[model samples]
Target: MRKSSSLINIKEVLLSTRKVLNENAIIDSDLESDLLVAFALKITRAQLHANINSPISISEQKTIQNLVNRRIGHEPLAYILGVREFFGNLFRVNESVLIPRQETECLVESIINYLRHKSIESPKVLDVGCGSGVIGASILKYFPNIDLISIDISPNAAQIAYENILKITNNNNFHVLVGDLIESIKVQVDLIVANLPYIPTKRIPTLQKEIFLYEPKTALDGGTKGVEIISRLIEQSTKILKPDGAIFLEIDPDQKYILKNKIQHLFPKHKIKVLHDLSGQERVLSITIL
Candidate 1:
């Protein structure tokens, strides 16, 4: 067999990949290039660095180029890579489900802290609009004793969530269902946690191309006011939430006051607190039933 002149070493390929990504105005081009190349080679980023001078065959170079082109076209890297890291665990992601965001981790932390403070043994939890099952799966991974039910309107999203929950926690205490918010839930739960659609319809177009063009609109549009679906969930939660149960929701920073008022009108005696993400943005809304 003759070696091809077009063959290149990993260092050369990486430099070229990084240059292409940079030229395309991709954020974190250096990091993305590393990830893309590593993914193409079926190796970890660390491993890629370890074998930096390794030679790349023509086929591997083509694969890397294909992935780079997809990203340059505004396809989300997570979708291209087939997984996303959320709360320290890698969950498979596709256009069917929303990619988990780092800010949403605040919601998860809030729920975990509350559960710890309450010291509830085997708390019954419900995760509404459980896309990719990141929130519910992270919770279950941390607290395996809790019984959780995750619901999504899309069957495909539900399946992805099911797989993630099973893969992440390996616990049978969770159920992933395809249904509207709590509509199919028959029993009351000790807590409800969700990171539902909260971006207003008009604002959808203003989102980054990676989100607006590639991600599912159904998972991004929260109707006109950005609270339509979330409001509905709050309304339905009243019927299935225990008296002392708590609800933790990820919301737009501007939505805190409006959502708080809504919660007040519905559960006047309950406690309402807005939790901030690392950036000091009003992110999570905590509503506790009295």
Candidate 2:
């Protein structure tokens, strides 16, 4: 015997929602389906499917329609689902920060590999401009002993990062600061990792609406050349990092050559390496203090 439900049909809603999403150019129909249903149920995607046939309550139906309308209007999937996966971990996210991109995971891997080769004493890590704490949290997850400090300029992003921290480790080893990159931290660090905004101000407006309109500009604007934050961080990092410490960052492919030249000019003896991403794009730019 089935219960008579006031709620709309689950399968019907998913079919209609999938069509709506595809119309908006969302190619991953499966992900779109899961996200909408998850939002409607106020449950994890896994849970949503686990009880797929279960009749939805009336209130859930209302919530589903509202969320689907928002998603159809071009809101990001991360913003709709309220989560993002990065570096093999799930982190809370919202419109407050730039969604974690797979490209940045290469930056984290480079640091891990470099540490393995150098056999350095467990290094203390600092992740400046850590939007969702993904970079810092991933580092912590891999090397639990690495002391970490992460910061974001937006308080909302910082709050999201803090929530993520609470979900991960219990040790107070990780510090989440809210402000410009290095201004809030007092302790010296052994490794500096940042994926700061590198999109030039002039180009931001030309980007797709999902980025230009939905995402916060503070996390995207990089001034005239998209090097403003990186340049400042490089100068300040030199003073705080241990002479033997290293720094790694995710950079736009076109900007790598200029950054490499700048590092060579300012610190002639130090060595710099431009790592390439999966697509062979120049991605993680690493600097070793000699």
Q: Residue pairs in steric clash, candidate 2?
A: none
Give candidate 1's error at residue 226 in angstroms. 0.5
Deviating ranges (above 4 Å) for candidate 1: 1-4
Q: Write the per-residue lDDT of candidate 1 for residues 106-126, one digit (tens) a residue.
A: 999999899888878899999
What is the Å distance of residue 11 in model 1 from its true position? 0.4
Cα lDDT of model 2 by residue, 79-165, tens digit:
888788887777888888899989988998998888777655667788888888888887787777777788888888888877787
The whole-model lDDT of each prediction reads 0.93, 0.82
Clashes of each: 0, 0
C-alpha TM-scores of all predictions: 0.97, 0.91
* Poorest 10 consecutive residues by lDDT, candidate 2: 1-10
* Top-lDDT structure, candidate number: 1
